[model samples]
Target: MYYPTIRGCIQALKNLEIWLDKAEQHAAAKGFDVGVLLTSRLAPEPSSIS
Candidate 1:
């Protein structure tokens, strides 16, 4: 059970990195600053879980 949980966590992190890289590329292709994209968030407020 713990092994599957750990694997899932690792996979989630890898997926996040992949998404960030894609965002960076998309920003560059659109002639926008990657920093702007990086700083922008989908959430208007901070999460309690973090």
Candidate 2:
């Protein structure tokens, strides 16, 4: 049980790293700052969430 949970967490971290790298490459291709993507949120504002 614990093994599977730990494995899942590690896998998720690895996937996040891959996604961040891709986002950086995409930002460079579009000539925008990678920080823009890094700092972006799923919602326009945190207060908007209920």
Candidate 3:
């Protein structure tokens, strides 16, 4: 059980790296700052969560 969980976590980290690389490339191609994309949130603001 622990082995599978650890493996999944490793895979997730790998996937995140790949995603960040793609996002960086995309932002560069569109003439935007990579930092803007990196700092973006997928969910609504904290005040709206309530």
Candidate 4:
């Protein structure tokens, strides 16, 4: 379980890095700072009731 979770986290991190790279390229073309929208992951979620 831990191993799979760790691997998933690592993959997510790699994807974030790739996203940032693309964002940087886009920003450079328009001369602006690059960043990611982490709100989706940071926001609280509803608890399961069942």
Candidate 5:
């Protein structure tokens, strides 16, 4: 199986961060903890190629 390159992984993480930031802001306005609902990949996980 072909895995994502470092650049691709970086891009995916960046996009995830943006979405997570938005969700966090929304949750904060409602008095909720974002961390409880979100998890960040400090390192990438294995992905199966289809």
Candidate 6:
């Protein structure tokens, strides 16, 4: 039971690594800084109430 869960987590991490590699390749091809990809956010920052 736990083995499958652990395997899934490892697979997800591997997939993330592959995606990051692809992102780096894309940045190189586009002549952009890899930091741009590293610093990007998927969700908008929460606004503070005044």
Clashing pairs in 6: none
Model 5 ranges with Cα > 4 A deviation: 1-4, 39-50
**Best-matching candidate per TM-score:** 6
What's model 2's overall lDDT? 0.93
lDDT of 6: 0.94
Rank the candidate models, highest TM-score first. 6, 2, 3, 1, 4, 5
| Candidate 4 structure quality by residue, lDDT tens digits, 1-50 | 99999999999999999997887788789885554433235645556333
TM-score of each: 0.72, 0.76, 0.75, 0.61, 0.53, 0.79
Model 6: per-residue Cα lDDT over 1-50, one tens digit each? 99999999999999999999999999999999999999998876787432
lDDT of 3 by residue, 1-50 (tens): 99999999999999999999999999999999999997889998999999
Q: lDDT (0-100) at residue 30 of candidate 3? A: 100
* Clashing residue pairs, backbone N/CA/C < 3 A, model 2: none
Each candidate: how many clashes? 0, 0, 0, 0, 0, 0
lDDT of 5 by residue, 1-50 (tens): 23558778889999999998899898899897887566655546656332
Q: Which stretches of candidate 3 lie over 4 Å from their true place?
A: 42-50
**Which residue runs does candidate 4 get wrong by more than 4 Å?**
35-50
What ordering of candidates by lDDT runs from best to worst?
A: 3, 6, 2, 1, 5, 4
Candidate 5 has a TM-score of 0.53
Task: Say what the RMSD of model 4 is.
Answer: 7.3
List the lowest-lDDT window of 10 residues for candidate 4: 34-43
Please write out the lDDT profile of model 2 over residues 1-50, one tens digit for every residue: 99999999999999999999999999999999999987988777767765
Assess candidate 5 and give its lDDT.
Answer: 0.78
